[model samples]
Target: MSFYKKDNSDYLEQAFYSLQGQTLPADEIILIQDGQVGADLENIVKKWSQRLPIRLFVNRENIGLGMSLKKGLELCSYEFVARMDSDDICHPERFEHQYNFLKSHPEIAVVGSWIAEFSETIEKISNYRKLPSDSEELFFFAKKRCPLNHPTVMYRKSDINKVGSYFNFRFQQDYHLWGRLLNSGFRIANIPKSLVYMRVDERLFNRRGGIRYFQIETQVQKTFLDIGFINKLEFIRNYIIRGCIRLIPNSLRKNFYETFLR
Candidate 1:
């Protein structure tokens, strides 16, 4: 099950191609279209549906992403759920690799992978690769930002339900949801492989990007506070240290972030 928007037709094609190339293709692909925005996703789905079963949940009203994801989870008929974004390319072996890994390590509630982030101008500016392995390390990595890439996550359906599913109307729902899951004693793991190509929208380089990131960070910190994971001082320390890099000049930040951190 996946939530997608329009205006990302080409990326959607790449996504479908990846899914089709998977060793174990999805039995049913449920796409949650937020609303009909003059983007003919239905037509594309129709063309692809002949080869694979595609079920689209079109919302008459424009529901937020968090709600759409929750709705998809509720409606999914599978035991496991793999997440994909409308504008990302998944690796051909993503499903097979994650599925096998999860089967071998049943203790993990969620599994994610590294991703390569490309600019719309076709330059690979940054990468978001995860650490080698260690659930605890992954947990620590998530303190400042989302350690797990959303598009590369595959999780147990029951585990999500155990945590009460996705938070309603949360802007940084993924981050907040991860905090809740960890607090509830769920473990997260990452495969040391790049399984997705993430595309950075050009607009995200502007003021709006800063605002969105700030909102996500605020919500993330609030979750940690509410769960008693960190005190005020600790939260402040993490906030400053983690976001300090973004304060530097963009060129330097981009180089450092991509070369070292990733």
Candidate 2:
């Protein structure tokens, strides 16, 4: 997992505590410090390092999520890597379930699960993101949206590397990665249960809009078209749909996410 300057110390502690509570605990937990995440978080990381099997890697400068994950992926010494966000809470059986699923289904390279979205507390989950149940549905669903919940995923390191791993997409890095994975014939699936409580608020909706974000979204769509994941017509449709969603007022965009995307 990767953390930045804005991550809450208490949340980071809770996230790590969840990992510690896992039934199938991680062999090596890679915690990448994206830039300088301040002293309070650093102290928490240092404390957890002594408690959990955390292998810490510090970045001298702030490098965004994609590059930070790329670094973390390189540092990971295991075959399968489960991803967790520093501010999110995981169910105790998440790792065990995903690990077993991977072992039983060798054809599937990435396995994710539903995520419960909470605002301030994990206790009061406000929304749940239920994804397509199998790889076939997930591949088709990728034409318009991200098929898997990013924070709820455990993927194979070798497969992720084979597809060129993560890239530098600022707004929708996971979506872009899914496109390439699906296009390259790698299979992905989602367990039909929620395994993570993802923190979300108005900012989550706000972060997905605006002119610059729309430009990046367009670029991602173009990349999809070039990769043969989507044809020219579907690309135009996605552009129009995304344009409406991204260029709209923030309140309307929030409603769009709530009414449809979630």
Query: Which candidate tops lDDT?
Result: 2
Alpha-carbon RMSD to native, per candidate: 3.0, 0.9
lDDT of 1 by residue, 86-185 (tens): 7777778899999999999999999999887776522454556665467998777777566677778999999998888887534567877787888788
lDDT of 2 by residue, 182-243 (tens): 89999999999999999888998899999999999999999999989999999999999999
> Candidate 1: where are CA atoms >4 Å away?
1-6, 119-128, 168-171, 241-256
The 10-residue segment with the lowest total lDDT in model 1: 202-211
Give lDDT for model 2.
0.92
Give residue 244's error in model 2 in angstroms: 0.7
TM-score of predicted structure 1: 0.86
lDDT (Cα, 0-100) at 109 in candidate 1: 92
| Strongest candidate by TM-score | 2
